[model samples]
Target: MGHRFELHKDVELAATPEQVWEAIATGPGIDSWFMGRSEIEPGEGGRTRLTMAGHVEEATITAWEPGKRFADRTEPGPDGTFTAMEYLIEGRDQGGAVLRLVQSGVLGDNWETEYEAMKVGWDMYLGTLAAYLAHFPGRTAAPVSAFRPGAGGPDAVWAAVTRAFGLAGPVAEGQSVRLAVDGLPPIEGVVDLAGLPTYVGVRTADGLYRFLYSGAERGDALVLGHHLFADDQDPARAERAWQEWVTALPIG
Candidate 1:
């Protein structure tokens, strides 16, 4: 038999199979959790292009059962090997579901060592996936953060934040909005102002922050403020509070 390597791990999620499948199915969804900007043609004989950090790989989908299973095969690394990966989702007796990832393939020399390294990588990645789904179920867009020490005062800060966050795409001045960041809960808020003399506050998904904003300053300094639930909350909660606060600020 050819030298083969396998790695498998299972995680119990607080989401339904359909919810988990959505995260892995859609292109942006896949990017948010696994790779970046995935081009997945669902169903048999379809193909998926996953951009890992900066590297890109092409894979073919061998099977696709909505809310249940997704399998793909891809050419190996630079050495021209090959790899097969599958994601299996099944409902549990209690509720929620279990997600299992099975990766198998032949190997070159040092196969055992390579397998161990990959095991760690997948463990971290899957943990990220789980955390993402648990917080923001069906959302998949990264938050934007920018800072401008001194440009045009409040007007400059407004432009900096808008440009950095990419909020120039037909957004109404006084409308409510929500955005999702990978591994973080969604942000809910409204655009308080469009130019100088502006103020905005966003209520986060986890209710950690009641408000976050940048003020119109007289000089080269702008003050940013973020309201948190409390200091004694979980570290994750506190971090999210600060992140949402920072992400909402304008960048220079």
Candidate 2:
């Protein structure tokens, strides 16, 4: 049986509606904040695609209104499962803009688990968006992604990750972190977002490093969705290095 669900979230950004529109409606813009590599075709009926780790998903644009609103819907699968997402942007008189997201979908047997995971995932992505607009507005970022399979539940996996980073306990926002991984130079940054087992984001001088727990069931227990704004960084190489780093972690 298929079950339907919808989620609503609103985020206020310290950016103009046009700026917010650019981030949501363009490929590079989306790449700066959201997961995976994304491509958007113009106008209503055009297509939107996201590619990650050799997996590709595409959706058709259902509504497009430039800086005002954008919406898309995925084709139904054989089990009658489909997903739709809508973003509404409204400028505030005092400045900035409010971006509202409405995501609705139909799921197969594991609806409850999938719904919970999606909820957590969206929260992390939206938080990243706000951070991007605040700290790296108008800058294009090269996206870096990596993932690792994991066992155990959320708490256990999260604990292992914290231990690998030498964190004593839960990650705290504003706390300092220094990374000296193999193949990469020393990285010094401060935590900007920390949401327990689900996500943690760090902001350095030129990057936003986001770590996500895509759920134990999904097999991608640890995911790195990073945005590097520095011109010297190569995304593909960074991704490979991070993948190696994640795989080598003592999380098992």
Candidate 3:
């Protein structure tokens, strides 16, 4: 099939190639930063499964080498096309590692919409990955999201989101921050993801915050998501707190 879309990104990780491999190759490791619950047999041709928010996704390991490289491709999507994904790891001569992601495939008839969404999603997930290594080193995360249509431009919507999260303002990737909302305890983390009025994120001691501006052409929408990294409890409380805060924001 003629591949119609591709997205590639490279991120510097404050980790070793082995540490990076742990998060990318193993199921439990991926669970720490990527999916809801993941199970992967890392040898070539092994099975890989990821369950997210009750939905399951499967893939086959196309390539694998411990502490080096890994790759997988999903089953054909609705468009009769499959997305081939790859992770290339290189240990820097100075120290640390560089992780690269290349996802390419056909995106069917709704290519533009799907492609854009995937780009944004990757930005959040990958940034979360780096941040996870920095703080919550060995914990897996569960996702919870809350979004609502808004009544204004991206700038205004983003402003409202910042105020709600107690963020001083827009931040740059890698900036350390501490959030102080009125009804909650202090939340602290680093800005692993940042893209102006489009997206921003902070990976905290126990989780991550991914804030977004969406559907502006139709009617703006503000989406706030949490990736909670804990083994004992459901993410319900965090989800409810965020949903209520968004509803009470002055943006819309």
- State which candidate has the highest TM-score: 2
Runs of candidate 3 with Cα error greater than 4 angstroms are 1-3, 35-37, 149-153, 167-184, 188-192, 217-221, 229-234, 247-250
RMSD of 2: 1.5
Local accuracy of candidate 2 as per-residue lDDT tens digits, 1-252: 999999999999999999999999999999999999999998999999999889999999999998899999999999999999999999999999999999998988989889988888888899999999999988989999987766457777777766655577668998887876677767788889898778888888899999888775677478889999998997778888888888877654
Report, for every candidate in turn, its global Cα lDDT versus the true structure.
Answer: 0.58, 0.88, 0.76
Candidate 2 clash pair list? none
Comparison by TM-score, 2 against 3, better one: 2
Worst 10 residues of 1 by lDDT: 208-217
TM-score of 1: 0.54
Cα lDDT tens digits, model 1, 144-193, are 22223344455555565555344665435455666554454456655432
Candidate 1: C-alpha RMSD to true structure equals 15.1
**TM-score attained by model 2:** 0.95
Q: Which pairs of residues clash in candidate 1, taking residues 3 or more apart in a chain or in different chains?
A: 76-81, 146-250, 146-251, 147-251, 147-252, 148-251, 148-252
Task: Please tell me which predicted candidate would have the highest lDDT against the true structure.
Answer: 2
Model 1 off-target regions past 4 Å? 1-3, 76-80, 143-252
What's the C-alpha lDDT at position 44 in model 2? 99
